[model samples]
Target chain A: MQVRKIMCACGSGLGSSLMVEMNIQDVLKKMGVEGVEVVHSTTSDVHPGAADLFVVGRDLADFIKDVDKDEIIVLQNIVDKGELEEKLRAKLEA
Target chain B: MAGMAEMLKRENVQIVEGVDSWEESVRVAVQPLVDQGYVEARYIDGIISNAKEFGPYFVICPDLALLHARPDQGVLKRQLAVTVLRRPVRFKEEGPDVRVLVTLAATDADGHIEVMRRLATMFCDPDNITKIAEANTADEVYAFFTAPIE
Candidate 1:
């Protein structure tokens, strides 16, 4: 599956999600991946076709459980680049 | 939008002994912003209500929480507050205990990205959180927050 866009979301769409978005960009850069557009918004934006993938912290995982499991990355630690890189790599490879 | 350093002034950063509960912590963390008219009093309620519904997702990393609510909920301006709890507070029984509550009052979704980026840089190093939490004075905490990011 080709991934082009990813959305990181949280309850307020202000803080945590934005932090995750930066982390996603960092991981993508480190992996030498390009052309993946990343954005952050409220959890309300997590819907089918909203984006190729949705990223959120584990606390908000239930909000996006309805989305395809393959398209959602629920981070146990939003600040951990290692976890994000591993999960992003798996999803990109799969 | 003010940069994170400008938004977090020395007066906005504080070190308190402790609070009775997470709710109180939010209230206390947000109190300075409220007093300065950066946000309305309801903003505190907004953060607490959002927490009640979504759990403490703002506890973005261990021992740290970035407190905020929907901009429309009550934000009057863009600002940041750092409240260091000498005694940590836990938002949930299983959640990490938080010692630093960084209150974020953004006027819109995108205005605070730069500030959040600075915070992301600081939080990426967990020791920064510990350092801020252990700061002896508000001036020290303010310096840690406003210091240029490498």
Candidate 2:
């Protein structure tokens, strides 16, 4: 889907979201996928076109229901890089 | 801001037998930072209020939580505290059991990004999580965080 930007979000945008953003950047680097700008912010900042993809923890998944399913990645474990890399690979490939 | 090891002082790390509820867990987690003056007493309340509003958004992974609130809530300086519960606590009726609470007090939105990055590297490994959770002393927990990332 040619994702150029990914936004990782949490309730406050200070802690968990930033962690996910870092993991995403690492995964992207390992995957050799360049040009994707991974950023972190509060859930309130999520919206259509806010980014090519919106990633959030499972608890906060309900908050981003307005976004398209294909553009959303709901993480069961916000700190699980393996889960993130697997799901992100699927999404990027699909 | 200091690195994760420097930001989390030895005195700020603790191992508690258990807590009655997740609220108590949050209180225990942030108490060190509060006592050290990194955050105002109300900062604890801020985290609880935020959890009530957002539904334990800080439980970043199973057995671990990074408790925090907005910068303006009551942050005096950016710092961290670790509370290891011998018995795990749950933030929700069906949420994952959380045993380690890493409380963060950031004075701004972006100031703690590097610290969070180091934490990301550590906590991503389940072994590291277990190492801190099962730590016998505050020094052990402190050393786990302060140790060079392999």
Candidate 3:
């Protein structure tokens, strides 16, 4: 499996984004998926070069308009850890 | 009554103290949310069950223990940080323990400091904390969170 770089972006890139990153990592591990690199970024710093996929929170969804809709993932709430993991895994495989 | 601080002061709110373990702390923190109709009682049970399966400790701090908890739910992880703020550093003798944790999802220290300052102004009254610790019902706890400190 290729180690794809995943960036979790949010308004401040500190609290919520980090939470999502941790959740994603946990889900991947539980599912026995490996070689995925997870990172965190602020909305302003998110660029195509930094990562292959951008996991964004609902509050910052508008900021990523320039990015391809297929490349960006918007989350209203990050509570369902399983759903998020599944979504990311599907994206990675696709 | 809708302000964050005001909503936190309701009378039914109880600030439980001596939450040594993560399970104990979560139970005390979610009680008011269930009692005040903010969250369903079943949800509270679910959180507890999840915590038990994944390991306790959801409060997000600089500490690595938070990461060790392996929270499967993103909302639950966020809630852990928020719950930390709701947990009372101290509990009153008369009422239920404080159940609400207000977390600042700020990334930098500056944001955390700013939110803390605002929270202090809103919920830092000596009387408010005192009365909050003594509150019995969820209504009383809600009053404490909502009431303006004199």
Best by DockQ: 1
Q: Give the Å error, residue B84, model 2.
A: 0.8
C-alpha DockQ of every model: 0.89, 0.85, 0.04
Scored against the true structure, residue B70 in model 1 reaches a CA lDDT of: 92
lDDT of 2 by residue, B56-106 (tens): 989888899999998889999999998999999999999789999999998
Instruction: Report the poorest 10 consecutive residues by lDDT, candidate 2 chain A.
Output: A58-67
Interface RMSD of each candidate, angstroms, one decimal:
0.8, 0.8, 13.9
Q: In candidate 1, what are the lDDT values of residues B48-136, reduced to their tens digit? A: 99999998999988999999999899999899999999999999998689999999998888888888888888888889889998989
Q: Per-residue lDDT tens digits of candidate 3, residues A1-94?
A: 2347888865445445666777777778887878889876567678766777888755467667677777887764443465676677678677
lDDT of candidate 1?
A: 0.91
Q: What is the interface RMSD of candidate 2, in Å?
A: 0.8
Q: What are the runs in model 1 whose C-alpha is more than 4 Å off?
A: none
Rank candidates, DockQ, best first. Answer: 1, 2, 3
Restricted to chain B, the TM-score per model reads: 0.97, 0.96, 0.37
How are the candidates ranked when ordered by lDDT, highest leading?
1, 2, 3
